[model samples]
Target chain A: MPSFDLDSYLQTQVERVEQLLRSRSDEMGVQVPPRLLESMRYSLLAGGKRLRPVLCLAFAEAVLKQSNVPRMVEDCACALEFIHTYSLVHDDLPSMDNDDMRRGRPTNHKVYGEAMAILAGDSLLTDAFALVAGGPEPVRGVLCRELAVASGSSGMVGGQVLDIAEDRPAHIDYLTRMHRLKTGALIRAACRMGVLAAGGDADALARADVYGDSVGLAFQIADDVLDVTGDASSMGKPVGADAAAGRFTFPAVLGLEESKQLAARKVAEAIDAVKTLEPHDGPLAALARYSVERRS
Target chain B: MPSFDLDSYLQTQVERVEQLLRSRSDEMGVQVPPRLLESMRYSLLAGGKRLRPVLCLAFAEAVLKQSNVPRMVEDCACALEFIHTYSLVHDDLPSMDNDDMRRGRPTNHKVYGEAMAILAGDSLLTDAFALVAGGPEPVRGVLCRELAVASGSSGMVGGQVLDIAEDRPAHIDYLTRMHRLKTGALIRAACRMGVLAAGGDADALARADVYGDSVGLAFQIADDVLDVTGDASSMGKPVGADAAAGRFTFPAVLGLEESKQLAARKVAEAIDAVKTLEPHDGPLAALARYSVERRS
Candidate 1:
């Protein structure tokens, strides 16, 4: 119905990426900070779509061979996921979302308590870079730059600043800008990094960046839609929480009908962005559609 | 003359370091998140021995003819200090150390509240890597690895695990080992990074690491000594707070007299570690003495 089986394809690729990341976690089984490592795993392995890492992998495959990034990619993807999880953990704290449940389980602060939740989030964010930092100097250096750009001012964390400020405002421009940085920066980085890790070309990187940016916006809008118009049981968390926050979102600003149309337009742009690449056939095509159409 | 003129030397260097950090806080300038950036400056400019960066500069001179890190040094040094300050902020959070004050001001969480404190800490930590990432790839890569090792499980964070787990009672050897990883890891990384940044030889790196390790332990003991013997006035924070938390220290495990003796021995080892370098004098020697004796 959506011109492709988005769910099965995404689920398959996401599983592959998750399995790869899980392997790296096993290898990083260092001794001293056993509990620290355990806590990291608790948050990391908590099930999600693995969307970010798969995008990284699928993009890298456009340039690199499929099997080339077994070790490095896992750590890179794991670090990104850690950043995402840490944000969710902190954002759900009483001072923020006051969410008690996530991924159908107790939120980190709920399970670990507020203090541990705070510390756990802190450690995960710090360790995200540290995870990549332990590698060879050149690769680690390049990877650090890639990740720093993704996570810093012009990237995900910067978006967070705008997002919090938007809780009161109703401006569409501010909302788009916030969504660009908050969600788009990391997703773009993940795509670009996949190329970097696998020695992809400049052209590929540029195209993927465009694709990732478009889809990142589209994906967040989908989130807004699900939040307002989703089923609680199927979504695994509260659906209308965003509206309840009286916060900015696509639907909040553009109305539900327009929000859906905008998401589809962005998805179309993302698909067209990669259409020129001959090697961009499999996962990349599937990914653009999945970004817009996935239910969860 | 109290063996060495540590007070005068420390005063000038600490002031210089604080000044350097404050000015560079604005280097990323108006684009940075205002409150988050201000919080970063608040902690970085807070007075302390600029031991980490000084060690960096010392090792830079000791390893090569640079005499000082280039203009870029300030940004990177301040970045390292930011990482340190962020760790302290998070460590002192309710989930971690639960300390109420740091560097004479209400700890970040106390002033900004927990959510901001957590985000502030996350901002600093991520931005630290962002600074390095944006720098020259080769230098940034090596520096990133050095920092990652220090910040992660094998280092400071790992030491933190040992700190909390060892909070009750454990083998003295275990406690000491934990402290080395926790505090010593980053301090050692700071020195090692100066060499990496300067493109020095293995021999210089080895000496710096050894010196850093010994001085790191001595620094902790001086902290313990101050916890018991110094005042809240000079220290700028509550004294005897560690004992209240049931955390162990050199004085707690060994008597005050024995702790002082051990401190002296560690200092001797630190001095010897760096003495092999050609033509060593001034700040490095003064720092060794200061590490064992600083009141705050």
Candidate 2:
């Protein structure tokens, strides 16, 4: 089998997700105040890897085994991106990471003021549900449940609290748990939601779940590794910001070499989990490898 | 035929909503970090009128014409309260209204610090979707859409931005538009969601919409009037606080007497709109009057 062109796949998928994110909010008939909408669009349109939505689209295509996926998948993909973007906006706030820079640009709060930034994050998060809930019936509710549970208190938000707790332990188990919830949950939801949106069967869903879990963990470990080893310019943010903030990270608790090994192992597991759909190197497999390979 | 006991109805419904909110998060299987849960409960269970949830329940009962409402209505009612509580938490943030007190207690940020307060608010908002999505099918998606639309960017958050806009006009139209999106949108959602959950048809929904709009505006105008004339102890926050903050209030723009008169007219209109539900002074009618007549 021919090797998949991972760069071309990512670029195509990213552009698709970007277009939907840019226009879907207007299509939904929801009214946002002008300045508030500006604040939301500023952060939302500020570029990223678009990883979650790309994963969602990839999963949908893989499950359908076709080029054209359903509109439901498209909506869920956009919703996943919105959720991911809102987290970034809130995480960069003055009360959270107090980040001044993100994605090679000024952070949302830095550019829009803390209040507008907070509201922007709030709007993005709320509108995500609007997007998912607007999808086709039955699966729409399931998607909402998946997105909410993954991103809500027990999922991403819970992980955030753990990350910020002063008394939190710096052990590997604690770090893994925090990362699993903080970043892992939403990524898993993104993959699973795509399958659900595509009307995939239970077996397909279970496989997607496993692939999501492995890739999600690998992505975070790679993030931690990048924070330690990558250059600031390539990474778009300071290389050691996490360590400087005393954040509990994989490299901090498990050493740099061990973290790299764990990420590689997770990538292998992710690739293996998706082997049924694509025996040879496929987009999913390449994405798993790229999760660790990417500099930022 | 007789005067509805507004106080008793409020007490019974508020207690039911309070109980549901206190326990529903656990029932939803959404895991909240302990401290984060406490921070959310600190403001959520701090005890306001529980007006939004109560309105939801009342509408559900009115539409069903029975004592027992569906569990879906209960879930949505709790979801409405969750959204309202979250808005209050965010609104009181240091970067926003900077209110040190709410409902006679130190505000969320004052108790949990700014970061936890923000997370608590985020959790509440996200978990509200969780609750709605966990409800019975078809209607579950509809309920999620309604809740999200009413509370998202164009709804409540949009209104907050308008309220805080530096160049916002002090006219009554601006105040009305701002409140309609902010407090009005969610309150309207509470009423419409109850009807939707109960399987009420278009006419029922339209009536609820009218009732919601009229009552929502009246409530805000009365609130503005209270800010001018009510005592701090009774109100649970300082009287004249809104005016002191240079907020554009109905009373400030229309004068106290005119504001009171406008609220009365709105209350009358709300009661009239809901007459089909209970021809005489029903719970809905009494609640409309209470919008303007209440001391706090």
Candidate 3:
């Protein structure tokens, strides 16, 4: 098969995600209070790379070898985006990261007040389960369990706890574990959910796990590198805020060159991990490469 | 049949719930940062009425006429408490109600700092779904869907948004709707889930809904009354907090006497709603009356 067009595939998937998210936001407006819905919609619709959901959809395609993404797969992808967005909203709260801006716009708490921001985050998190539970019956339990485990205490939230507790760099092992739970967990879940959606077997699930873990770590390291080198105009947030906040980042723990080399190695591992799903795995391979190569 | 001892039943059920919660908290401690788990346990195990879980267990018994609570039923009860605790933690955030004390102890944020407190809340909410998803396969989807809808944007969170929006008393209809979604949704879910867990039919579920809705409203109205008349020591927190916050409470919207009368009528209706369950529903019936009678 011809080499995959990574840009084209991502653009198509992103548009699909935006449309689903927009319709869901409109539905929420009718059901919830205007300002509350506005706060939720404000952050959710604010455009980002839609990277997690894209990976979910791409993985489903690779595993199923199907041209059309199933409705359940799309819904699961949307759920991933919602979970990611909610985490960002809560992470940007005044008490958390205290981030004033995100995705080139005022953060959720900045746009709506702190109370509404917190509620908006709660709503998004709850609604994500509602979305996944709407998937096909056979996989609903698995999907819900995966997403919850990936996003819950021992996963994303646990990582954030460690991140906040980091007064000083303790050890490289600690930082690696923190990033794996904080960012890697959900990224890993996105791929795993895709495999589940496509009814992939245990072997396929294991392969997806390997692919996700490598890419998730590579993605975070790349983010650290970008914090050191990327422009704010494209990244849509301050570049050096992590350093200013005394964050223990990849580049901080490892020198810039070393971090870059590590990210490159992880990306290569991610590509290799998905080889079993080849020729349909081109997009997944491209995403792994993009994890390190993207400025944002 | 002999009359059910409501106090004894509640005492036993509450103990069981406490044991489950303690074990779960211990599990979280092992998996997460100590401080994060500490923040969660501080609020979750701080001890309140445990009314929601009791109501859930009672309804399950009413529907199934069982002598002992099943493991799934117990798990569902724990999930309810977890969700309730998370809401309280987030509600106590400085940006939210900003209360310093809860259950006569310092609030989670006060003890853990704002960031850890927020994460603790997120963890609880996420963990609740994880718990429910672990339920029996046949009803796992339904349990997850029901809990998600009742606690999500259009339910409890929506009520909160409305609560914060109310600068003064809105129309009675609006206030009623807000309270129903806010406190009423989860109470209703607690009962509804009980029936679902027992594999009850539509009729059983309808009865649970009616019982939950009436008692939930009565419970909130009674809470409004206690805010005016109860002592802080007995209430485990300051009295008159609602009024001090300028919250549009039931007692504030309606005069004190009117609120008291409404709560009495709601309690009566709640008791009457579960009449179909006959002798088996004695605890549920007594619990409805207790909703308005309790000082805290």
Name the top DockQ candidate.
3
DockQ of 2: 0.80
| Candidate 1 interface RMSD to the true structure | 2.4
Tens-digit per-residue lDDT, B212-248, candidate 2:
9999999999999898889988898889888777888
- Weakest ten-residue segment in model 2 chain A by summed lDDT: A25-34
DockQ score, prediction 3: 0.81
Superposed model 2: Cα runs more than 4 Å off: A28-30, B28-30
Candidate 2 per-residue lDDT over residues A1-296, each given as its tens digit: 68889989888989898898888866653467878888888888888899998989988898888869998999998888888889999999988888899899999888889999999999999999998998878789988999999999999999999999999987888888898899999999988998999999998899899999999999999999989899988888888888887878898899999999999999999999889976489889999999999978
Docking class of 1: medium
Model 1 misplaced regions, further than 4 Å: A1-5, A65-70, A135-137, A278-281, B1-12, B71-73, B278-280
lDDT of 3: 0.88
lDDT of 1 at A278: 37
Candidate 3, A1-296: lDDT as tens digits: 67778789788888988998888667655788788888888989999998888889888988878758777788888888889999999998878888898988889888788899999999999999988887778889889999999999999999998888856456788889999999999999999999999888998899899999999999999999999999999999888988997888998899899999999999988888898886744888989999999978
lDDT of 3 by residue, B168-269 (tens): 355778889888998999999999998898788999899999989999999999999999999999999989888987778777788899999999999888
Tens digits of lDDT, candidate 1, B143-174: 77678767765677777767776344656687
Alpha-carbon TM-score of each model against the true structure: 0.93, 0.98, 0.97
